[model samples]
Target: MSIFHLMLSSVVIFFVLYAPQPLLAQFAQLYATSPANTGLLMSVTMLPLAIAPICYGLFLANYSKLKLLKVAMMLLALCSVLITLQQRFELFLLLRFIEGLILPAALTAMTSYIGQTWQGQCLRRNMTWYVGSTILGGFLGRALAANFATWWNWESFYIFNAALLILISLRIKLPPLENITTPKACSPKDYLRPLKQPSLLRLYCAVFCMFFCFSALLNYLPFILSNEYNLKDPKLIGWVYGGYLVGALLSMCAPYLTKLHNNNWVILTAVFGVYCVSISAMQWQNLGAFIVLFTLFCACMFIIHASAAPLANEISSAHASITNGAYVSFYYSGGALGSFLPGFIYQTAGIEMFLLSLLLICILGAYFTWLNYRIGSETQLGR
Candidate 1:
């Protein structure tokens, strides 16, 4: 039940955060706004996510993390309810900002909870599932939201997720765990602690590149599919997002992948290679091929991310939650960048150039991973 609760929260976070992605073009049209402005709807959720974790980790460090998680969950639910019912666009964005602030608390607490409860390989395996649930949640949220909106109304996904979160929050009972160290108080030093490690810093850089490319690509995909292939209906576009399920499936294999190679660098290089290949393939303009390659791209992304999170956990000697929060800050900063930056590129250059941009990111990510491995000479990870 504990693991179930953690995984459920993982799903809830991604589902709530990304449910609007596939509908960017729809929002653009509905509001008569530009793609960049519509993109901000997604950016607003992600930006607060990237920034809030630092504050949460810094200020709330000494508190009961589980209780904190529950409070954050309840607040997120309230924000979602307001977002679901609000007819005004400005009001909806305001509610989403509040939801963003609440998410990091929930996530940081969960990280702290996991580090306290589990050990060694057992922890790695569990974290893999938690990561996989996040991937699945991300996939389901966007895919289901688009389809739900098509079937009924645009707000259906928000309403359903809001109701689900309330039930989930009520049922989660945080248990006392051994070996977990909660900080006594927040300080500038505590916030900066994770930054002092060389390898960890390298890993954070890699995460930034990873999400930057990944989010940018996924956020604009609907527009590419719609403009190039004339897939305007939300239902049809939602099917492409099934690619995220492919990512979720592969994410579950992170532990196994680690055992085979026993090195995260190898895994990282291999996945980024696949990412470059798949991204380059996007320029071909074949819908079937695009979807398949996009699936591979998202899959590779989750695999690398799942593999990397454990490394962050292993390397952070203390304050695992703070380190995790730092990693998430970088991770989502990449995401927030990707969410809105591609609009100008797509507007001026076209989908082909935009994909090429991702291709460049894949190369840079691979380089950073290889550099980190060489410099840190870290042990065979995920052992």
Candidate 2:
């Protein structure tokens, strides 16, 4: 039941969060903005999302998980309602930023809730489902909004999601849960001490590049496909992102793959290689082949995500929460920058250039993956 509740939390958070992405074309037309400006709408959510974990540690550390979850859920619904009602484009963007601030708490609460509810292997499997479900939610959020926009309007996402969140909040239950709070006496140096470890910092760098590539590709793919492939319909564009479901399913294979492979980072680097190959193939302009490669790319990215996340969280047993939080902060920072810069490059240069940029990001990610593994192995042998 806790897992089910966490999945529900994931579905609604992601569903509302990405509602604006598929509508970027419409937004540009409505607001008379450039591609870069419209992309800002998507990137804005990630900005505060990146910053909020540090703030959470500094100020909101004492808040209970259930209490924060409730506040976040309620405010999320409000943000959705406001977005739905907002006719002014700038105001809408601001509201999306507010959603960014609210989101991390709710998401953090969901994770902490799961940790409280389950233990050992049970905890691990449930966490995997948590990841899969969030990925599914991201897919559905965009897919459903785009699909419904044809019948209703762009605002339909907010109207529908606000209602869903309200419904979920009304019924969801949890036992008393506490945040993995830093003790008030925990200083900045103390919190950051784990980061001085070479292997952990490598994981941080690797995950940042991993998410940067993933976010850049996902955020910009709609624009490229719509403009280049002559598939401009919102509904059609939304369906293209269904490739994310392939990633979600592949993420489930993480546990098995790590079991067979001696080093998770080794598997990660190999997967990154496959991911780069697939993204590079998008240059072929063959729709059938493009979709297949894109699906493979998604698979490899999520597989890396699933493997690296647990490794980052477990790397510092004494400060697991801080380690996890730092990784996510890095992840969202990558996402914020990736979402913005690729769109700017795509706007200024060309789609070819954007793909070239993503290829570079992917290759760098693979390097960092191997670097982390190599350093960790040497440390073990040296010991």
Candidate 3:
């Protein structure tokens, strides 16, 4: 039941966080904005998320993880309701910004709960489940938002999200565990301390690059579908992300893949190899092929996530909260930049250049993964 609650909470966190993705096109038309400007809808939410560790770390350090989860959920639900009622685009952005502010409380609490609750096989099982739940939530958020926007109105979807979050807050509970994450007190420096390790630095950098590539592709995909393929229907556009479901499946396979390779870096390197190939293949100008490649793309990304997340926490167990917080901050920092900055490339240079840019970023991620592998090997030889 505790795991189920955590999984459910994980789903809702990502669901609210990503719900706006597929609606970018609709929002553009309604707001009279450019793709880049409208992309800020995704960026604004992610920007706060990027700095969440530094921003929210101390506050979360002192709070009960379960209690913080409930409060954050209700606050997020309130923002969702306000976003539903607001008419002005500015106000909507503000509401979304507020949502970003509140979101990390729930996210850190959940991840920290899992980190502090279990160890060994139990830890791997629960973390993979949590990752799978998040992938499911990401898929549902976009698919449902796009479909709902088509059926009713764009803003009304938030109302539904608000209701769901309220229910989760009320029903979900976790057994009180001894909180190991709190320092005598927390400072921004405490969170920053985890980055001092060379391997953790490489892992965080690799994660940043991976998510940057992933976020840029997904954020701009609607425009690609609507413009390049001449597919205007939001329903069909939503279905394009049907490929995203494979990520959940692949994430669940992380423990298996890890055992098979017997090394996280090796698996990550291979996944990024596939990730790079998928991005390169997207340049082929065929929608069916692109969808196939996108599924592979999503798979590679999530497996990397499932592998890296636990690895980061394990590496910095003395400060699991700080380490996990930093991991998430780097993850979304990539996402925040990826959600917005690449639009200029897409808008100015064309899709080929845009993809070329992402390909380069993935290559950089693969390089960092290789570095991690080399460092791990050296450490093993020393041992």
Listed in order, each prediction's TM-score against the native is 0.87, 0.86, 0.88
Residue-by-residue lDDT tens digits, candidate 3, 1-383: 38898888788778898898778878888888887787678778877888876455555555677888888999999998888778888998898888888888778878877877777667777888888898888878877887888899977788888888999899966557645545563556664665698877888899999999998998789889887888899678767777788666866788787666666678778888998999999999998888888888998898889877877766663355666777788998898789778999999999999999999999999998888778756421111
Model 2 alpha-carbon drift over 4 Å, by segment: 25-39, 58-61, 115-120, 153-156, 172-184, 226-239, 318-320, 343-353, 377-383
Off by over 4 Å in 1: 20-39, 84-87, 143-159, 175-186, 228-235, 378-383
**Which portions of model 3 miss their true places by more than 4 Å?**
23-39, 149-156, 174-178, 181-191, 226-236, 376-383
Ranked by TM-score, the better of candidates 1 and 2 is 1
Q: Write the per-residue lDDT of candidate 2 for residues 26-119, one digit (tens) a residue.
A: 8899889887788778778878878776555333334566676777888999999888778887998899888888888777666655544555
Candidate 3, residue 150: lDDT: 85
Best lDDT among the predictions, by candidate number:
3
Residue clash pairs of candidate 3:
none
Q: What is the lDDT of residue 126 in candidate 3?
A: 85
Go through the candidates in order and give the clash count of each: 0, 0, 0
Error of 1 at 210 (Å): 1.0
Model 3: lDDT of residue 72: 92
In candidate 2, how many Å is residue 346 off? 4.4
Q: Please rank every candidate by TM-score, starting with the best.
A: 3, 1, 2
| Cα distance off (Å), candidate 3, residue 335 | 1.0
Better of 1 and 2 by lDDT: 1
